[model samples]
Target: MSLLSTQHTLQAYYLGLFGRAADPDGLNYWLSQLESGTLALDDALMLMANSDEFSERLQLPADDDWLAQVYPAYFGRPVDAEGGGYWSSLAAQGVSAPVLLQSIMASATGADREALDATTSIARFYSQQVSPERYDPAQTLIQEGLRSNEALYAELAAMDEQFDALTVMEVGESLEGRPLYSASVGSGPRKLMIVTQQHGDEPTGTEAAMLLLEWLSGDSPEAQWLRSEISLTVMPRVNPDGFERWVQLASGEASPDTTIDPRRNSADIDLNRTWDSSETLDLALIPEALAVRQEIARFQPDLILDYHNQNNYINAAGELETISILWPTNDLIDDQVTATAQQAAVALAQGVAEFDYGFLSLFPGGDTPQIARNGLAIDGVPTLLIEQRGLEEMELIAYEGLAVNYNALSSALILEGLMSMIGVITELGSGGLTDIDPALALQIPDRGERIQYQDIYTLSDERIDKEGMPTETELQPEVVGVSAAVLDDALAA
Candidate 1:
């Protein structure tokens, strides 16, 4: 078969099983397998039908109801009597679920085929916009080719057109002249400024910020309530030049240069460090950081969440740490700012605790006021640091011994960050963040020694649950009228 024919077949399998367009990695891998005669079209379809994403996405019963769902899922119609009887007999004769799905998909024709072709055409168009290294757990490198500068602009532009409430703007330009953009929405009294990917090498937070923006722009009742209660400003990607170089290094398009650090800007300045004393900073040296500072000055957010990715390390319990969080540890920060930052951190710790896979610990951050975690707080802007797992190691070791589902890890980090933001916004809107005790931030366990990826699973359940203390609503029910369960439902929704 021609390449086009093979792609159409694969696209149908992706649609029927995953309910989405194929990622370039998976599509290319399977296409090569078919073209090389290593696997037939039926073999590929059967394998995909039995994959974890397939089973998790469509939880069809193993009994006769499977036929009821499968026919409609693939062909856009329920099974007719004759087709139902044939599939039912096959099942009765002990045919497997994957095999059954493969058979049903093969039987499409006429209007069903026409519908499939039209939808597949649309899916193909979507598949084009997605980069080759877009998030895929099945692939080894979990956070590869995170949205390019162009892609980020495209997505933000589309969001601007789609959501009337969301406003996407160019806050400043990087030293390389790439426009630094910020998306702002909501109209409540409380304001939040969330900046992600200060370090170009750290890219997960960029995706998480985009996810949060889309959620805030949504029409759900919880989302609507959030808009009514708070204003938000999100700087999704701060260091595009560093990110561009990082991508080049990852894809082997560029050789490593001794003078250049992918974690800093093109001018070799650590963007996070430039914020040390925003008043006296040399703006020409770090244009990216200056852009962020200017936006913060104008927006004057009540709270700032600085999202970033750090090296992987096992917690004090020896289990791999999924995220490390910290409030301002700088002594120069005001007592009130420290307390408010602590409240936000405590709230975030409790929120992240709900996810079973999330391993939270205190980030062993610097006391230097240069980093946003301390710098902004010193200036009386409440800031919290979120250091998620999986970026430094990815560049250093190339995912060795990290036996994890990249897809799940990739998504969990984003959702965990988004939910943390939502939880904080909810509490801040209801005036519940300030009343909580500030000592809880000090109580968060310190990050343990760094370990190789292979050592992550060595220890079992001894990991500390630092935020084990009562949350805002738990400690003071009157402070936040919204129940924890209600807030949780809203975040999930």
Candidate 2:
């Protein structure tokens, strides 16, 4: 057979396995990947993997390092020594490249990690969005995805100690005993405590918080100002166990269909709700909550900011919302605190708008004092909760819907709010965060606060007609386009 004919046959066979015929474009992509190091053929494994570059296919199956092939395919970087050893061990025990790739994709890699290793994922989705000529190895990160706690801590520890204003310490541990860390910056007169991801599954806040850490650690004027004027304490991931649970959910070990949100720790108590609860007050039931509550007592922050993700039932405009800040319910909230938060919220929203970046709004309705934002508010510390967009929706809004990645924009807005709040305290001489405009906060729709938004379904990233059927357009075609029929319906799976 001709070389072209041989390629066509192989492409046809693979597509046939999926109950679909070959698209010439997909076949072309497949063939190009063969040259770009995508493992298109089982027989082409390079046994002597250490060479890094295989001048000629070895045609022998000796040291087939599935890890080597997949590391670059996924992370846009080679496997580290430890990773290479681990996966090479699996390959030595008889795993093939295809099997290893399947396992990697199935494990905790999730959509965000997969987005980085874009060539192997969602070619069809990007075909319309990103130009084929500009294909980079790792195409995306964030967009409703999360960084693993290990990955996050590694990055944090690796940051250079550039200033005395920054200090990293452990505040407490999760129910499963994962160390909870806090990064404290600044020694200013006022204190601002920011806690993120009290609910493990809510990871966008943690990502945004990391950006704040990076910014504050820098030599920028803003960083220097924040360092000298306000003491900032941030616990990026408060619910480590729940965050791990989110990783498990992505890996298919846990199901999102659970009755209670899997964001609960091992004891199955909602971490956010545990605050101020009778049981948690005495460190009775929720140890995780106690750890943070104790810290809050010691910190006595003038303002507390909690970050989170509200997911898709929100973001009604089919665009990435910059952030939604929630103030304490006015009922029991300190008038001064509310004024400060309201002033900060107004400035935060204005900053995002000024950049022409993401849209910012407020939590329109009354606050529920049970959640961490309101729960912490009860302590007389002003509080604001920031809800960033979820994954698929964030991807559409950040990657496809808008200009730059929403993360930088998100980080900036968060920093602005923190700065404004703390700045208010610093200028206490100018009369502290007095007030912005109650009318301004009222302008933001109570879209997410309403109970109806809670009890309903929201559309996924894929295109749907008025009848709600999948349209030709798909945000992640590889993830969703198979027929709805079960693969093995007889098993009731």
Candidate 3:
């Protein structure tokens, strides 16, 4: 069988499995066009092979044999077994060959490049500009990459040395008597408040802050833009005591037999809901709550961002939502304040959506005064909370132990989240965010609640329902709000 001699018609039956990997129904449309000779075989194959849906379905060596049989379909002729074998070996490596692996690697390096050259999507922007090499998610999760209180201070000291504009200050102490630190960076008029680690178990937000510090320490355009345009107030870890317990566990001081999450502070409280008001900041005997409020009071930011993480949510239908944002509001706030916060929320969600279109959502904020995002809004300072779906959920399957996988995923999730924050600030800085519809934010559906939500399963491996708190929405991606596309368009323009 020669590659070019025979003109074999494409089989419309397998079109559902191959080209239209995302939509089974797409086969019906393509099938008619395919069988009618309207849609060329090459075009149909190209559509399926380059898709993210195909990437997930790609089974490597397992698919290699199936592909040996499918090559007749791929090339419109029975491909030589020897030739197919040569190509199959190459596909195992990341080096993509356009003709052989177009369906799997999505047109190989050369073809993908050609496609990328003609058009730009938010996904392409991240792949081109913010490559994973620049912002490593896994490296920081390792032992050396771990950010302990000591590690954070050391990094901060080095950051201060690297950038004179960012000076680390000791604001207060944790309940366990660890130093609580804050930083006032740049001299720009806009004061942006960034708080992290209100929950001791949540450490990636602080890691993201460290990444921010490192970025600002550079002479890059982003660092320079931040220096000249905004003053960032960062309290990287408010709950040092809780983090310390986790750190000790990570270091092997405590047995892994106990539950991995060391969430509470020295006095044992979820500090996020501890700040009722300035006078009522104390929750239980946890001093971390007041310490965080003191830092917030010092900055008096016009816009506030509270960062945290939640478990990755997967509904009964098997859809995943990795990030969720909130424009937290109270009765004292007006539509304008809500809109402004929504603006920030939308921008961040938009920034993140490029990475995974269906992974983000903008939901109602906590109505309680005790919630930091809501409590901060009572004073009319528009606050946005970025809650990344928990990377901790991916520990075992994604990597090694709970510590390693959790830490690495947390760093990655936070970096992705931080990108959205950066995109929001960039949109605001460029004056590209004027009169954008606020209702567009709600168009991003809230992620649905998973029926079997849990932290790491119990020691016996039971998938426990970790929290009784139910999310207000269901989880699915294809609702048609181009939140990320809108922000990406603004950024690209």
Candidate 4:
């Protein structure tokens, strides 16, 4: 084949294996071996084509290091080693290659590189082939699409008629003077707030929120009821500057060629950690956080949802543990909300399963209490934190294959379910507050197989042995007294 044809074939092959490049290093090695005449490309392709190992390696799990190496090459840019990993960029783009690759590899296989390449090329050609009669030139569909800030803003400007009822509130200016946009809709007495992109690299939620904004402002009957019954405030892009920086870095247009900085705004402070506390050195260091805080204080939303992505689990707040239908406050209303969210999650899990994606609820941790959910709960606004698997590690499957839109569709379903239960929200706050039972406290087992209660706390070293087995330590009378005091305070709440 001519060099042009070879390049075209290679591009097609690469596109065909969207989520499948199992053993990227091995693939590269095979390519090198072919170039050096050490191994025939046909033989190498045959090896990959026949092996289950190749298929297994294509699934990029959370701990896999191959993603760090392959993603940069695919994007035609070098990923930062000091920062998290290439998955960060994938999260920003709202797409995972591993999931897509799994689907591609299963569909095409051949003994020769040329044959494999041709098969992939044909596959891509057919996948993108659209009938002229059925295609609409004016219809805007953002399926698996990424747009820069300028392009997005332009699109929003053109679609202003659809968003006429939505009021744009400029909370603050980015370090680069870009006006941060927050959409406020509805005129109901009760206010609900949502913020996305707190970590700029996590853009799936941000995109989902934007899509929701458009849907709400449109003439849907559901939108009309939501507008009349509740006031919703949404901050779509909390870190526009970081988002722009990531875009530039991913596109190979970044100046100075420094590693990608994961922090928000100009000051480089973690916005999530800069909440109301003494550790907050520079309150103005993160203008985005300050702006959000001001908005929360002003609106005092009855409920809030902060969207984020994780490598492992989908989690909700601990506050949703019980049905609060017996309380008379807005915070208790979350029982129905929690139930609705769980039902939606089950549907989402079923959808993701079609693509072989694993789903689980997030574990309760100290970090959860320090962030938005716990902080908002203190102010009486019950919050739900939603987490989805990182985009870089999604499983690939065959039409319902890896390209299955689980995260996007799950988000929509959750929103739909929430809207359905909106009228019963006031009933959630009907439950009365109760103290935690000391008898229900979790017990930790020691290495000696001894059980301990709240009155006997163990130090880190004393808690575990050299082999990571739990260890036992005798508690001093004073220590036991102090533990009792702490437990009493805790249970008395």
Best by TM-score: 1
* Candidate 1 residue lDDT tens string, 1-493: 0112567668767765666567767877997998899999889977887788878866543555666655443444456688888878887787776666656655554334433443444344334334554433222111222477787888899999999999999988989899999899999988988999888878777776776777678776667878998899999889988877665554444566543677889989888887678458678979898899899999998889998888778765556677888888888888888888889998888766644344788888879988898989988898999999877544542212221223324444655665577667777767658677889778888897786543433322232222332222221111111122233344544
Model 4 per-residue lDDT tens digits across residues 177-259: 76666677777766667787676555556655555566556555546655676677887667777767655544334542363
Model 1 alpha-carbon drift over 4 Å, by segment: 1-145, 278-280, 397-406, 454-493
Query: Which of the two candidates, 1 or 4, achieves a greater TM-score against the reference?
Result: 1
lDDT string, candidate 2, 433-482, tens digits:
45456457667755433222213223234432223211222211121111
Candidate 2 residue 288 Cα shift, in angstroms, is 2.0
Task: Give me candidate 1's TM-score against the actual structure.
Answer: 0.65
Best candidate, lDDT: 1
Which ten-residue region of model 1 has the weakest summed lDDT?
A: 474-483
Local distance difference test values of all predictions, in order = 0.68, 0.50, 0.54, 0.41
Error of 4 at 333 (Å): 16
Give per-candidate clash totals.
2, 1, 5, 24
Candidate 2 ranges beyond 4 A from true positions:
1-145, 160-163, 254-260, 277-284, 313-322, 364-367, 391-432, 435-439, 448-493
Q: What's the residue-level lDDT of 321 in candidate 4?
A: 11
